[model samples]
Target: MVSVTENTEQKIIDAACKVFIQKGMDGARMQEIADEADINKALLHYYFRSKSKLFDRVFVEIFSDIVKLLGEEINHSTEIIELIERMVNNYIHLIRERPFVPDFVLHELNRHPQLIVQQIHQYGMDFSKFQLLIDEGVLNNKIHYIQPVHLIVNVLSMCIFPFVAKPIIMGFMLNGDEAKYNQFIDERAGHVVSFIKSSLLINNPE
Candidate 1:
């Protein structure tokens, strides 16, 4: 059971995420966020002192969610292919659920690289386990030799690029058809998994 305070704080954060994504930090107002949260300005202020503070909180939470997802996937999967599949699928779903996140995060990252770097340090994102998995696969002749950083970057780029380039891909490539574009995105995980397996895994069955 969640406490009232926790619930209210989450409500504020959720509202803030939406507002910040739409209007951005410069355009968003505190009263607007309070209204979006369905709470009075005083109550919103009780939870967050200022718009800057609230934006920081929202940014940290969103970034933390991604880091946590990666950490969880790394811990749970035993095989390199399994980890890639899980990460690709879940990452796509996450972006779908919060479509505003990638754009907002990218903007913030450009403006405040230091803040994002601090969050990464705070989270202590360890990729050594993922590296070990890759090493194991290589030793067992399951996959080709690849550095963990390259693997990680490749997977992230494939997972995130579609969403980040939604306008071009959806507008031009998809003919501005949202339904078709959605279907494309929905089928993307399988495509990505297959591509990775075919490229990396020896004798991988199509």
Candidate 2:
């Protein structure tokens, strides 16, 4: 039940995301985005006043989904290990679906760190539940004592680094074979989950 206007807007947004991922904000042109969307430049400009505005739209659209997913995972998971597994699997799938997201966000992080921080704050993401899970695990002797910050950062780094460094990883590790690279990415979630569990759980066999 997508209206024509909504569909057109989504088309523009999707086109903009692709161009931004490929050329980044500095190199992407409005006309190119219009061409990608199969729309006239005038219509594109009418919808989005400028490239920066369009870029912001794309970033917010993608980042908001990521923040939402993370917030849900933190809120709903009862155990730290379950949270870790869900986070790794979900995060990896998200990045794989939006392959340009990690690089775009990383670039923006360096360029507009404050803006990213503001968006996360606006999302109202609370880590108290995550920390509580960690503390509970430690108290129950199910996992080793570790700061939630460290664990959170470690898990995030592991999940994001592969996608952020995709080109290098694919070239160096998989000899630029796209199929094997994808397979590596597919297997990465389980590897990350196992690694984190091994580090945190006292009875981890792997």
Model number with the top TM-score? 2
lDDT of 2: 0.85
Tell me how many clashing residue pairs each candidate has.
0, 0
lDDT string, candidate 1, 1-206, tens digits: 12354578888988888888888788888889889888898988788887778888888877887788988998899888899999999999989987777888888889877767778678787888888889999999888989899999999999998988989998999899999889999999989989999999987878
Best by lDDT: 1
TM-score of each: 0.89, 0.90
Candidates' C-alpha lDDT: 0.86, 0.85
- Across 1-206, the per-residue lDDT of candidate 2 in tens digits comes to 12355578888998887888788778899889999888998888788887778888887876787888999998889999999999999999878887777888788778867658668668987988888998999899999988888888899999999988889998998999999988988899999998888888998887
- Please identify model 1 stretches exceeding 4 Å from their true place: 1-8
lDDT of 1 at 8: 81
Q: Candidate 2 — which residues are off by over 4 angstroms?
A: 1-7
Instruction: Give the range where candidate 1 is weakest over 10 consecutive residues by summed lDDT.
Output: 1-10
